[model samples]
Every structure is written in C-alpha cells, then in structure tokens.
Target: MSGDLDLELDPHAVGERVQARLDEVERAGGPAARAAADDAVRELMLLHQVALTRLLHGLTALPGTAAALPGLAADELVGGLLALYDLHPVPLADRVAAALPRVAGKLGREVALLGVDADGVAHVALTASGCGGGCGGSGAAAAEALTRAVQQAAPEVVEVRVQERAAPAPLLQIGRRDAGVPA
Candidate 1:
C-alpha cells in the first residue's frame, strides 16, 4: 500500500488471489486450522486498516494537499483504494462511466453506461461492434465483465444489470402467395 511500492497493484486481482489461498486452506485443513487462519487474516487486516487510516490522515494534513486529490484519484491502483475507502474525489456514477471503455476493451465490444439507478444498480448496455457476439463475448460474459469493471471503479455500486435485448425478428416471412394456384 506504500506510495513507493510497485505501481502495478491491482486490488481486485490481489483480493482474488488471497481468497483462493483462503479457500485452499479451508479445503485442506481442519476446522481449528481454518479458524486460526481466519483470525490471523482478520487481525492482519485490522492492523493494516489502522495504518492506512493514519497514513491518509497524515497525508491530508500536509500543506497544499487539497490540490492533489483529483490527481491521486485518477491513478488506477490508488484510485481503486480510495474508492474502496470512500475517499475518491469523483462521484460513483462518474467512476462507473469512466470504466466503460475498459469494460468494452476487455469484452471486445462497445458498452454504454445506461445509468445508475436509485438502488445503486448500474445499468450497462453491451452492443456489438458489427460482428455481433462472434467478435466479442456472449451476453452473460459481457454482464460479468461489466459487473467486475464497474464494481472495481465504483465500490459503491451494489449491483450491475446489463440491459436485456429483445429477440431478433425472423429473417424471412412465409404466407399464402396471391391466394391462387402457382403459375
């Protein structure tokens, strides 16, 4: 979490890795061991949280610190951490809108930020870039990608709902021809 540390910290990826390890322990160890591991994790998290709070407080207390907030919030890793702690200068909807391009890139399609509803559900519309789902991803995959991207950008988002598309119309129509015998 240090500013001097590697600049490539992706909190989501790190969290996934940590969860995988916890899952492994739960699978291979006894209940007692699992409890111990969980307690250790909890204690470590508490200590780190306290340190982070102190660090932020000290950083903000520095002279001329107000001018640097937006810049810090624009950084991917730092911005994510700030969002997680509700310190992000940008609003949650703005952050989600900013994440749309990344979501589109990852899904290999175009995505629109429909809106964030009153219930904190971010609506995203995934549309084909002409090649349809063949060139990009399926609807479910798009929904998942959008969800992950939006949640990472705006932790305040409670859920993501990809807009459902109507069923495609039939390509051809068949009916009685001229209502007479074929010539």
Candidate 2:
C-alpha cells in the first residue's frame, strides 16, 4: 500500500520537473532555443493532459474526491500556464482597434501608388503602364473599379457600414454576432 502511494505521487513530481524545464527553455532565445522550447512545451502539455485525465478518473472512482482535487478551474489552470509564457487572449475589438492605424497606412499607400486624390473618392491603377486602358475613368467608375479589383485581390475583406466616429480613420469591428448576445 505504501509503495502504491509512492508510485501514485511520482507523476506529480515528474510534471513539476517538466514544467520547470519548460520555463527555462522558454527564457532562452534563438533557433535552437525555439526547438528546445517547443519540445518542453509539448512535454508539459502532454503531462498536464495526462494528470487531468488521471484526476478525473480518480474523482469518478471516489465520489467526494472531485471536490478536493485542486479547486482550480480548467480555464484558470490554462490561463496561468499561458501567462508563465507571456501569452494571453486579446479581445477582437482591441485587436481591431490596434490594427486600425496599420490598415489606414496601407490604404494611404495604395491610394498614393495609384496616383489617386484622397478627396473621399477611390481609384485603381495597374502596376504596368497602359494596362486596362490606364484607368482613364470617372471618379465613381474608378472607385467601383478599384473596389472590384481590391475584392478580387483579397476576397476575405468586405465593406460594411459602421457607426461614425470623430476620428478621420475608420475603425474595424471584428467578432461574431449572435442574436441577443452582447458583442
């Protein structure tokens, strides 16, 4: 019985040692560093998964044991592990807000590259000269042409009306919409 208890405790000790090694590897930086970090992370993740599975099995075998098995929630445990590696989830709204400036800059570059005046109108210009009749079209026509070209180039992007803000640059809102759910 004592030997069985010692054997049962071995995984926890092994898990702690693996986690410590993972932390060390993460601190080192380079190509070799990344490989080491990946190996350590993989080992720790597997260990954690196995530990949780064993814990669950133990809980099922003995009814009140579940309540005593390290009260930390799954999210809390995962979040803690991620934080150790300087990782955390970022909200989509925050990401979009952060990305707005970069998007606006790219838009400005595209406009300038195409020799278009930024007077609330869009234009399209091919890289090659004399291609597609040199974009000699009306502003509205050019705007539509540019829109179609952009859509073709990057089909993932879609234009949608958003709430007007005081800022000149438009803000992107990225998230899914479920009825009656707060975004």
Q: What are the per-model numbers of colliding residue pairs?
A: 0, 0
Q: How high is each candidate's TM-score? A: 0.59, 0.25
Worst 10 residues of 1 by lDDT: 164-173
Candidate 1 per-residue lDDT over residues 72-109, each given as its tens digit: 87877777677656667788888899999987887776
Clashing pairs in 1: none
Residues 130-166, candidate 2: write the lDDT tens digits.
2233333433444444454432222222431122122
Candidate 2: regions farther than 4 A off: 1-29, 66-183
* Residue 49 error, candidate 2, Å: 1.5
Q: How accurate locally, in lDDT, is each candidate?
A: 0.79, 0.42
Q: Model 2 clash pairs?
A: none
Candidate closest to the true structure, highest lDDT: 1
lDDT of 2 at 15: 57
